[model samples]
Structures are given as C-alpha cells and as structure tokens.
Target: MKQDSTLVFIPSNLIYKQTGYLKGCKKCFENSEVYYVTSNKPIRNTYQYQCIGFVGETVDFKDSIGNIPLFINSKNGQLSVENNSSITQILYDYDRFKNSDLIHNQSEKYGQHFKYLSEKLKTTREISQNGRNSITKYILFLVQIFDYILKITRRIHQIVQKSSTFAHFEGNITTAKWFLTTLMEERKITPKVGNTICAKIIDLVIGVILTTYLFEYEQQIFDFINFNTEVIISNLRGLLLYLMGQPIGLKLNYSYNNFLGRFFLYHISLWRIFLQGLYPLFTGYFKFLVLPGFLGFSYQIAMISDVVSIATFHSYCIYIYAARLFNLQLKCLKSLWRVLIGRKFNPLRDRVDSCQYSQDQLFIGTLSFTILFFLLPTTMMYYVVFTVFRLITLTVYKCLHIVRNTMQTIPIYLLFLWIVNASSMAGNIHIAWKSFDDRGNVKIEAKLEKLPLLESVKKFIPESESPAKNPRGFGEIFHSILTGTIL
Candidate 1:
C-alpha cells in the first residue's frame, strides 16, 4: 500500500462539487487536470479511474484560477504567499480603527491649542492691567533667558543639517562604516546613542561660539533696538490719533472713542518715560540682570522681545476692556431675548426650557435689549481694532517660536545615523530573492535583509505631534462674528 508519487492539479470548485467524495468521472475531469495528494513511493503509468486525493476543507483552495493558493508562472519570477480573505478582512478593520484614532487625536490636539490660547490671553490681560512687580519682572526675565538658550541650542542643529561638510561626510559613510564596524562591535557602541551624544556636543560648541559673536557686537544690537523702539512709539501715536476720529468710515460713539484713545496716548507717554529710564541699564549689564550668571546673546534678543511686549501692554489693556464689555453686553442681550421669547436656558439640563416672566421682568428685558443693541456697534468697533493689533503681535511671536521648535526637534542626529550606519536603527527584516535554481525554472530562494536606510530612519525618529494650533480657526472666527461672541 505504497503512496502514489504523482501530484496533479485540479479546480477546487470541481472537487467541492463532489461533496467531499473522491470520484473519478468524465464530468469531473472535463477541462480539469486530475489531482491527488500522494506519498513519494512510485510514479503511476496507468490512469486511475477513481479520484485518488483527499477532498473538502482539508485541501482548501480558492474557487477561481487567479486566486489559487499556490501557483507557478513562467512569465514572472515572483512567489506570492497565500491570500486568506480572513487575514485581509482583519487588516481592513485595523486600518479603520487607526483612522478613528487619528480623528480623536486631532480633536484632542485642538483642545490643547484652545487651552494654550486662553492661558496666554489671561496672562496678557493681567500683565497689561496690574503691571509686573519686581519679583514678577525677575521671574519673567529668568524664564525668557532659559527659552533663549533652548532656541539657540535648536539653531545649532539647524546649522548642522544645512552644512555642506555634513552632507559630504554622509556620502563617505559606507567607507567609514567599514573602517569602524570592527571597533564599534568590540566596544558595543551603537550608532543611535553615538549620534545623539555627538550632536549634543556639536550643538553646545556652536551655540557658545555664536553667542560670543553676538555679544561682541552688543552696541550694534542696542542701536538697532533703539531705532525700532522709536519707530514703534511714533507709529503707535499716529494710530491712536487716527482711532480718535472717524477713521474707518464708520460712525462710533465720539465721546467714548476719544476718551479711550486719549487715555492710551497718555499711557504711551508714561511708557516712553519708563523705557528711557531703563535704556542705560539695558545698554550696560542687562544680560547679567536677566540671567544672574549667564551672559548669552540669545538672552539679550529675548529680553528685547520682552521689552517690545511691555511697550505694547497698553494696547493689550484696551483690548481686554473692550472684549470684556462686548462679551458682557452680548451675554445680557441673549438672556433678555430668551426672556422675551418665554424661554430660559437651564444650565443643569444644558438646554433651553419654557419659562413665565412677570410684567416688570418683561419691561426691564425689553429696555435692556434695546439699549445694548444700540451700544453694540461702538463696543464691536473697539474690540475689532484691538483684536487686529493683538493678532499681529501674536503672529510675530508665533512665527518666532515655530522656527525655534523646528530647529530643536527635527531628527537630524537620527537621520545622520541612518546615513552612516543604517542597521543600528533597523526595526525589522524583510525577505528578498537571493538565488535561482540551477534548472532555470520559476523557482528561487530568498534571504532575510534589514530595512533600508530611509525605512530604518522612520523607526528611530518618533512620530511628531500635530502642527501648531492657532488661537482660533477661521470657522470659529466666522461663527463668533455671526453670534456676537468675543473673538
């Protein structure tokens, strides 16, 4: 009872139609090759009249020819793996889950941005109105100095990424790898940690040199600062004067408008005096004052930015006052309108509910609504103007910080490691064709290989967070305009 040596091909649908039976017949054999599973005992010369192979789920195959579980093509030299539908379905479901996670992460990022904006708004208002005491001033100075150092360190990385020398070094990395591989293996030194340590050292040296250069030209920086400050004060004076009149072709409350405009102008006069008093101090040892023992030039530039922010504190104060008034009036008008409609908002239920109002309540609501409606245009105009000014300031700083972060966080060191020793950061291996059979048939062998440099780089560099969030998006701004909410 030796097993048959012949292996044959047959359509899976034909075998399935037999209901798990091994029957040899003209109908089953027509246009199909006879197939049988066999043990390697001997080849058969006579055709077996009955089917000779296991049938049904045990010998599973696709219903179609193109999707056969295993096949060899003379035209192509590829070996395709079994394509199970269940596995494909599982992959599809996983992709769908990842898509949902992407959306959830986006919303979470938006919330974080909104929170950041709100905090900045509150801090700006506080600084503008209450003014910074000596302790607060020192604290602000220390924080800004630390931020400057961080930015400079990031800038060093930027310099490295842009260097022609580094690019050339990357080109000869293959040679370097061959020379250093033996030593590196003996020392158990991996490229990942080596790249990081080298990058840090480079950044430190370059940052120190750059800061020293900037310090040497301190006088020129002070001159530029003085010129910019003068120009800003002059432009601000003109802007205040323009706002005091009917500047934008719209009729505003003349008395209130002029009062706010003149008050800020006087405040600006006081600021000019305050700045002049501190001018000599900045030109002298302001660096030491800002960062007790450190004398970095980036700190000076940051201190200059802080000074500009202080110079515009009066405008922020005006924005706060106008925005608050506009928001308060809008809220009052909304409540009164609800009362007129015989509805009130239930905070607990988070929805509007029917309500009954007395005659006095109705009268007061109506009167208040009418007054707020009339006064809205004046408050809105002030709020819009100040908001524009506030946005301009925010945009400038936003751009500056974006540059700093880009310099700081880009995976240049990992990328450099990828260039020099890609295997050090490799995460996985893939199979690739290694050789062909001597018979010149469609048969081949594959060898396992590490991921390529680009793919390995992805494994080493962690995924970055979403882009920088804005204080308000265009849709939110548009909605606020329609609803009369504070922007």
Candidate 2:
C-alpha cells in the first residue's frame, strides 16, 4: 500500500520553545499531526492543544507497546495512536510543530483586564465632575444668602434711624428684647428681660453671635472656592491681624490724650492760685468777690469741656465703626476681584495687564478716586484741627485778659480740651488709615455694585458722596438694648 503523507498542527502552548522547528515543519512536511504539551508553569495553564492531522497508524505489540492504549484507556477510555504509513515524515512533523496557545491566551486575558480598567477610569471621571458641580451650586446658594442678609441689615438701619424719638427708642428696645428672648428660647436657653440697659446688653450678645455666624459662613464659602486649608488659614490670619491692630492704635491715642489732659490741669491749677493772690491787692478785698467769679467761670468751662468731650467721643466712635466696615468691604472686594480675574494677590498688575479697551478704564479710575478720597479727607481734617487749635489758643488768651489774676490757670482748661480733641482725632485717623490699608474701599465699591437697593441709592447719590455719619451713642445704646446688660 502507498504511504500517506503526514500532517501536523502546532498548539499555541510551547510556541516560544519551538520557533526554529515551526519554520522547519512548514518546509519539510505538507501535512503533519501535532499535539500541545502541558507544563507546571503558572502562565501555561490558560493554553490549549491543537491537532492538524493523524500522526501514524496504531501499533499494537501486545505485551510491550500495547500498554500505550491501556494507559490512554485508563485515563479517559479513549484510544490514542499515531499512523505508521509515513514514519520518517511523521517524526519530522512532530519534532517541528510549534505551540501557540500561550500567546493567544495571554492576549485575550490582557484585553479583558484593560477593558475593566477603562471602565473604572470612566466612572472616576464622572464622580469628579459631579463633585465639582455640587461645589458650584453650593457657592451660588451662599451668594444668595449674603445678598438677603445685606438687604435685611439696610432695612433695619433705616427703620432704626427714622424712629429716633424716646417712645420709638423704647419700642425698638422692646422689640429687640422680644426677638432676642425668642432666639434664646429656640436654643433652649432661658430668656431674660429688663430695662433699656438690660435690653442693650442682650442686643450686644445677639449681635456678636450673628457676627460669628456671618464669619463662619464666609469662611465656608471661601474654603469651597479655594479648596485648600492652608491657603484659607493664611488669609484668615491676615484678616485677624488687621482687626487686632485697630484697638491697639485706639488705646494708644487714648493714653496720649490723658497725658495731655493731666499736663494741662497741673499748669491751670498753678495759674489759678497765682491769679487769686494777685487779685486781692488790685481792689482791696475784691479778691473775695473774685472767688465767686472764679466759681462761675469754672462752671462755664466745665460745660464747654463736656460739649467738646462728647463730640470728640462721638466722632471717634463713628470713625472706628466706619474703619471696621471699610475693612470688611475691602475683603469682599478682594474676593470678588479674585473671582473675576482668576488670580489672587495681584490686583494691580493682573488687572491692568488684562485691560484691552476703554471699558477697562473703570478699574484705574476707581483706584485713583479712592486714593484721592482718602488722602483729601484726611488732609482736610488735619488742617481743620490745626485751625481749631489756633482759635482755642486765642480764646484762652482772651479769657486771661478778664481774669488776669487767674491767667496761669486758664491754660489748664484749654490744654485739657486740646488733649481730648487731639487724642480723639488721632485715634480716628489711625483707624481710618488702617482701614484704608486693609483695602476696605474696594470691598464697599464691590458690594454697592452687587446689591440691588444699594446700587439704586448709588445712582441717585454720586459715588463721590459719603453716607450719613453714624451716631457714636448708637453703638452703646444698641449694645445695651440687644444684650440686656451694661458693659
């Protein structure tokens, strides 16, 4: 019988070990049979075997070689044998067949692994986008809340100002007390009510709490915007330092005033004694009459002193409050500027560099105007104080003419008044300067533009015009009414 050609098929497994033999197998044999080999290597487990054709005819040497059939039968009840027709061709085919199952299996496994990884990456991206959207929504909500609070405060201020009569004051105080008591009750704290003084104390307490909440809310909004705790903390420290410096400067001015007042009193007392000794000799026992005149003169001086003191105190208080308000305004402006420009701490350079047209002129114009406003007002006030001091000195000399006997003592009253006014002025100036340094004007400008009613008011009143001066007495009165306690 004619021998049939051997055929071979290489399994994927063991492909790497048989690259040279694979080339030989394709060249030497037209058709050859092949079988894949298994190994203990972990990587080889996913591979499988393949057969191209029959290897050879079955060979049964009963006692010796027939054990192959038995071995196959023992394992899986199947016969396993190679053809014998083309022995030489079959041997070559078997030697040259390449195993490729390992490469195929590895490719499929990695493809699945990459597919899972891609899915996870897409999911992560979606979660991040959602978080960003939520943050944006939260910021918008905070801005709305801020707007509402501003409107409420403005309305309250107007109402308080319009109703200034004693009855109105008492009514407001009563309302404040009720509001505070209700708030306390809501918090499960016992409520207390008393006279005007007590009410003011409560008002102060409530105001402080409200202020704290406002600050906390602002901080949260800031955190959302920046999203870095260290940056937020640094900015907060700057704000706190600016605030702390205000009271220190105020106290220093107060101390200076007291020293001046004491110096004036000492000189004045000496002058009085000297004048009394001189007066008796001028009109024989008229010195006794001069005592009564001295007493009346002292009363007039006391009244003048009281008026000056009260006015100075009121002015100083207003200045301090205005300074504080200005500081807060500047901080807000800085925040807004950062939002608009997409940069922080480079207001001048960044803003200016971005300017492309005349529309951008507004920033420079506003900055120039602010600087002028602050400098002009401060300069005018300084000159005015200087003129006032000159006039007071002239008045003191005129008073000395009538009471030449007490000429030495008149300087004491003048000095006391001068000291009080000077101290108060110094304190106010310090506060205003600090506030300006803190960039308050920028904030106020931003707020005025943002707020609806405020913007309307600004339209009617030019930007050059200042707001009505706040009453100094109102702080103490309001504090007492709100908190129900006296300081």
**Residue range 1-487, candidate 1, lDDT tens digits:** 1221111322212223222233221112222222221111122222432333322233334542223342222233122223311110000111112111011122341233222322322232212224335545654565565456545545674553333222222322322333244233323344443443444345345546756655777788789878887888889889878878887697877887788788778877887888889899877874554441132222333334455567677777777777778888888988989999999999999999999999999999899998888878877777888888877876765564444333323467767755653434433222223334443322212111234656554454422212333457879876765554554
RMSD (Cα, Å) for all candidates, in order, is 20.3, 35.4
Q: Which regions of candidate 1 fall more than 4 Å away from where they truly are?
A: 1-199, 289-308, 358-360, 433-458, 462-487
TM of each candidate vs. truth: 0.52, 0.14
In order, candidate lDDTs are 0.48, 0.31
Provide the global lDDT of candidate 1 against the true structure. Answer: 0.48
Q: State the TM-score for model 1.
A: 0.52
- Which number leads on lDDT? 1
Number of backbone-clashing residue pairs for each candidate, in the order shown:
0, 43
